[model samples]
Target: MRITVFGATGGIGRLVVQQLLDDGHQVTAVVRTPAKLPLTHSHLTVVTGQLTDHQAVEQAVSGADAVISALGPSLKRSTTGTQVTDRTRTIVQAMEAHKVTRFIGLATPSLADPRDRPHWEHKVLPVAAGLMFPNALAELQGMTEAVTGSGLDYTIARISNPTNKPATGRIRSGFLGHDKVASTMSRADIAAFLVAQLTDSRYRRAMPAISN
Candidate 1:
């Protein structure tokens, strides 16, 4: 598969790109600062650009078979004024223009995947994330619209509190945040599942959550 990824400098993005290369897929990683990506592979192509740049994004999406985006704001870090929704919007537009659809995105667990979630777990958490981080919640909610409204085959892998754990390659996925600290998953597992989606057609449009 020819895969294009956004937010390739982040922890999860880097892991996913590496895993894709190891899986023998052609990888094109799109990043804001190409110098920061730091990867060398015969099959890897690193492009420097952010999502708000339409021409740059359009060019990036030109020949991709699938797109897996781990793009989002850092709750603890600061870098730019860009929102995650803008990136999703660019991916959606580029996919629409190029007739490429399969989009897999990473999102927060607070956004309920009501279908895959238990009733009470779905209710309380999203409400809390909304109450505390209203702005971030709003940004993610806007992102939900950006993906769902894109008219493409999309999957939102709503992840738990992501950690930098080894890729055990074994993890559980669902909407079960009611289990206390189990609402956290490793960053590598999220990338694993994101890449897994590309090989399995059943994941299209499903919002699956990951936890350790």
Candidate 2:
């Protein structure tokens, strides 16, 4: 499949891009600076541009079979600084213009249905974090809303902690607020799970959570 990735220089984004290439898919890595990405594949096309720019996103996404966004900072300060969700909005518009479907985004567990979370933990940790990072969470929420509202075939993977460890190919994914929640997952696993989603039929319009 031909794929386009925004924030392709981020931790999870890079892994996702590499994994997509390893899986034999043509990948277009969109970023502000192409020199930062460590890609050397003939199938990998590095496009330099900012995610916030509409024309740049459209240029990267054109002719792609699917578009995946794994853009997020490991340590976030304010929602205003988060670009993934905002970038996603532009992506949605571009994809529609380009007529591309199948959008897979790396959202957070915070966007999961409130009722699905474990009650006690929900009230304390996750819920508190949601309030604390309203903007950050909003980005994910906005992306999900935009995708769903855009009428695209979307799968929002609300992931837990994404570590940089080797890909184990094993992790747990549940609806937001699932009782058994772990705090982390290797970035490798996240990327692999994303690749698997390209063909998975069970996750349409659903938000699936992942953790180690």
Candidate 3:
């Protein structure tokens, strides 16, 4: 598979790219700063560009079988303020233009999954998050809406706090409401699952929460 990846420099995105390469898939890693992705592989092609740049995004998306986005705001990058929705819209439009179907991206539980019967922590945590980080919650909600409405073969993997741990390659995953005890997932495991979804049809068009 030829895959285009946004947020290739992010914690989970880098691991996803590496795993895809290990799986013998062609990877186009799109990023604003090419140097941030310190990997060199025969199958990995680094494309330097911003997600909001349509032509850049198209270049990355062209000839790709799937697109995976782990995009999120970085505290160091002050310019990335609530731009996930805008970026997602641009990517979806480009995907439509190019006739690429599969898209997998990240989201949080704060977006309100109807199927999710909230655990006590789930119910109060997002409210606290909203109070502490109103802008982030709103942006996440916007991104969720954009992906859900894109009408493509899209899956939004909702995760909570991600840690830097080895990839266990095992996860408890289900649709938003199915898992009530999930609180954290390792970045490696999340990347593993995202790459697996490239060919898996079970979770197509679903927002499944994954955790260790």
lDDT of 1 at 128: 79
Query: 1-212, model 2: which lDDT tens digit per residue?
Result: 99998778888888888889888999998878877797899899998877777888889889999989876633464437546667778999999999998898877665545347454434565576666765666666676777878977888777756677887766787665454657689988888888889999778877777777
Highest-lDDT candidate: 3
- Per-residue lDDT tens digits for candidate 3, residues 44-153, read 99998878789989888988899999987542323336678789889888998899989999887666555666556567768986776776777778878887887789
lDDT tens digits, residue span 1-212, model 1: 99999989999899899989989999999998887788999999998876788999999888899888888765633333447877778789999999988898877766766565455656776787766666666677778888887788988887757888776777676555433335667888878888888877765776766676
Leading candidate by TM-score: 3
What are the lDDT figures for the candidates, one per model?
0.79, 0.77, 0.84
| Per-candidate alpha-carbon RMSD to the true structure | 2.7, 2.5, 2.1
Lowest summed lDDT window (length 10), candidate 3: 73-82
Clashing pairs in model 1, backbone N/Cα/C closer than 3 A: none
Question: Looking at candidate 2, what is the lDDT of residue 73?
Answer: 39
Stronger candidate by lDDT (1 vs 3) = 3
Per-model TM-score on C-alpha atoms: 0.89, 0.87, 0.92
After superposition, the stretches of candidate 1 with alpha carbons farther than 4 Å from their true spots are: 76-82, 175-181
